[model samples]
Target: MDIDRRLKQLEDSIDENVIDVYDSNYLNIPIKLAYYEIDKYSELVRELNRIRYACKTYEEKELLIKDYIKIYLSSRKMYLRILRNLNNGAVKILYPDNLDEDILYRALKNFKKFDRGKPLNENLNTFMKVKLKQNIQDSNQELFKLKHYPAEYINTFKTYIGSKVLRYRNDLVIYKDAFISETEPHIYSVYFNEKTAEDTKNALLNILAYLNGHPSFYFTENYNFNRKLSELYDQFDLLDMLRLRKKFFFESKEYKEPIFLELPVLKQRCVLKIQITK
Candidate 1:
């Protein structure tokens, strides 16, 4: 694994094209390597600057910088490992003769756990899980807590409420660290403390399911689709939150109890709990 070899590959990469890779032909094999760079340095530097500017002492920077270096080195090693696999013919590219076969082959090769493979309760690789978990931990949270959105998103109506709100694939997002409290019984919280977005979404779906299942709990949406939510939340959030399936709790016809001074609906108990399992 010489630097010269990678440089040479870079030169040869110009010839690689999707038209050639996807065409019907004889046994033509295309070996492509796209490096996925894992970057933590910028975030680390930001932490360092924050600590240097504000922290009473700069002793924290040493430990944090050291950890960042370790992570950077580990990322380099993984890239090398992936390269080694490609060099050793362990990782396969597309065959113009049979394009889909290699995809199945690669999936079978990378298969680790038997998962349902849905986004809700979706699985992440070890490194990806670690990366995501690091982000959550770095947000100055303990192992777990019922999270709340930042004070900026202070709308009583439809809104996303998560410390780390990820609008990953679509409009609807995972919410946390937020509760509108009128009474203990009338508290609907957007809460999260999960390792993966899938699990968080699964928890959300479960909450939705529970609410939908209860005969006493009637789920109603605002008839007006024209009026959008605040500009604070994304256009997707404003749109998705109003989507009947994603409307967990919002300003509906629930006139009896209100979230704001005179808001219509009562923010019901979202009651998302986080527990650590061995």
Candidate 2:
């Protein structure tokens, strides 16, 4: 109920050895969130409580709570999405070994986006974060007022922050998967059947300070064609938006076909049987 108590509970729940299920079929599903660190998550809980007791409702409370929700909401939803969308009834998470947080940047050094004709010169190029395409809802406002959706739209693939396997649930998952499509149809998904890297886990918890909203999580920019920013953050379905993560980082080479990266899932058994009427 309180910060320390909750942190204790979370500490209790984490077992780097904890596994979700034995079925190998589900292992391939994860994209990547981050290596999860209970201590880091604990810090967030503490920060939020500090704010709660320190701030009045009219003060930063609303904004802080909003930021607090942003941190945990996606985490709470991840495995649930597997149970909901995928053909599953339960999901389990694990503390990663290296969850290999350092892999992405290293991999990206030689990273060539899946669909792009040119390989990225990491020093000279950045994996642009594409904002989800959107339109003016103001009863078809002036053409100038409409959002400047990228011409590449869905195919504008982005980089993988391995921790994403943890921080984001269905939304980031969808986006990553869609990015996979941008590669080649031969590219398939895979996971570690274990845990992630330490940096990867910590990275997930590190963003807690960005209660104001982290630009790294931006799916689409709010600028119009003229580059003016819009106040509204519109929504887009993954079906409309699109795509997850892994290995191949230890070696220095271009991406090999048929796979994106490997996210690790534990092999221990943890299940919550909730009856649902589908």
Candidate 3:
């Protein structure tokens, strides 16, 4: 693709009215493109300085400068191709339908923010965190409606064990656990569960189905519970695990049993009967 032409197209797609000071929409070009442009310009400046330093004669310097200009332009086009390749890979995963306006801007912004120069999987994990936060916020109402289980049970369980399983739309069960303090809930676990050990895995299957079908469905790559549930789903071993009453401890420590401790909860306190003799 022609880099110059693509840049022109991107510029033309910007909505002037939406480009305000408060929001990032003012950035008519993708953030990645901006970075690329900056890098290319910097390279050009350095090459020009190098030519000036090397050539003593004006004519020789002119020739070198012209040659460097041509080289820079060629390299700029190559840089665009590189950007296109990176953008293409990101689009393949994100699957944004439109690249004309806000969607394009957001897509580029998201990719730029999440695309740490790392392995694809690592970049994907970063992207998922952003998407997950958005999904949770956007679908908050839908999720709240799915919480059919009594609030008493939810509250009590959360207080004691820092976990709550709520029924969602009768067909789905959502499990969320807070690994942090009970007073300040920070959910580290979120996934669907079967109603019973022998029950058909309809709820989880439905969620997977939903996610598969809905490209826009919010996702988090590093969701611990989701990963575990997905593994179980793949193996069809959720029922077996449930039947075995398998317990997972996110944190564990070995300590001596309390029998050796002198303090006992049930032991009565004895008061000395010696009256103060004045």
Candidate 4:
């Protein structure tokens, strides 16, 4: 699919003069903070594209794509944080000047009805007004402290966050496709060893079962013990191996609370060498 070519095309489209546009808008402090975050994210995207283009092997490219996915997820979280803060700041600014709680709550009700698609109910409106008043009071106390920053400094920091958000979204799709193209053929063949394939398959099925609200089986790992019932022992050993593998997957922040079918066989606790997933 010429993924490198697409990446280069996307990289080239990033506007260098986005900050100047933000400066014209005369946005408040929260939006300005968002702009600065966008600048940092853009720089990261540029560097990631550079490294991605340099990859020579399929494995290297796949690893790079995985790293890009991590970066994309993190960037999305950062963007959402900025947006939330900006929304909170907006609510503070739009809050009623009058100190009367009843008056402010009424005003907020009207504001929410017009601004949000689903207006906050009466109970939530009451809570929001209380919180908004507190935030506004806090902002007033801190406003003077922000005056020390020069106009030039703020302008320099007015970077565009939207462009980077779009770029990362595009990059994720492209890189994900590239990763699949590179790895799909060899995923079961080259990646899965005969000794581990059965256990790995069972572990994945167990995880799927849990997701589907079904009970899964667990196996115990017996390292040194040998028994006449070879098949039964082998099944138990596979379960333990699956348990160990599940532990490693759980260590990744991407997979939360990965469920395993079998528990580890505890005899003498020994450390298992955990390999980083590519």
- The deviation in Å at residue 75 for candidate 4 is 1.3
The C-alpha lDDT values of all candidates are 0.32, 0.29, 0.34, 0.34
Over 4 Å off, model 2:
18-24, 32-278
- Cα miss at 231, model 1 (Å)? 42
TM-score of each: 0.20, 0.19, 0.19, 0.24
Error of 1 at 160 (Å): 38
Task: Flag regions of model 4 displaced more than 4 Å.
Answer: 1-37, 90-278
On residues 218-277, what C-alpha lDDT tens digit does candidate 1 reach at each position?
Answer: 112542321232222223321233244434335655433212222111133554322211
| Per-residue lDDT of candidate 3, residues 110-194 (tens digit) | 3556433565444543444354344334334333432433221122111111122222323332433111112223321222122
- Pairs that collide, model 1: 121-198, 147-176, 147-177, 148-177, 148-178, 161-176, 162-176, 187-268, 188-268
Where model 1 places Cα greater than 4 Å from the true spot, the runs are 1-35, 39-56, 93-278
Error of 3 at 203 (Å): 82
Query: Candidate 1 lDDT (Cα, whole model)?
Result: 0.32
Give candidate 4's error at residue 71 in angstroms.
1.5
Which structure among the candidates has the greatest TM-score?
4
The candidate with the higher lDDT, 2 or 4, is 4
lDDT of 2: 0.29
Task: Compose the digit string of candidate 2's lDDT tens values, residues 51-112.
Answer: 65565333344344444444354333332333242223122333233333244344444432
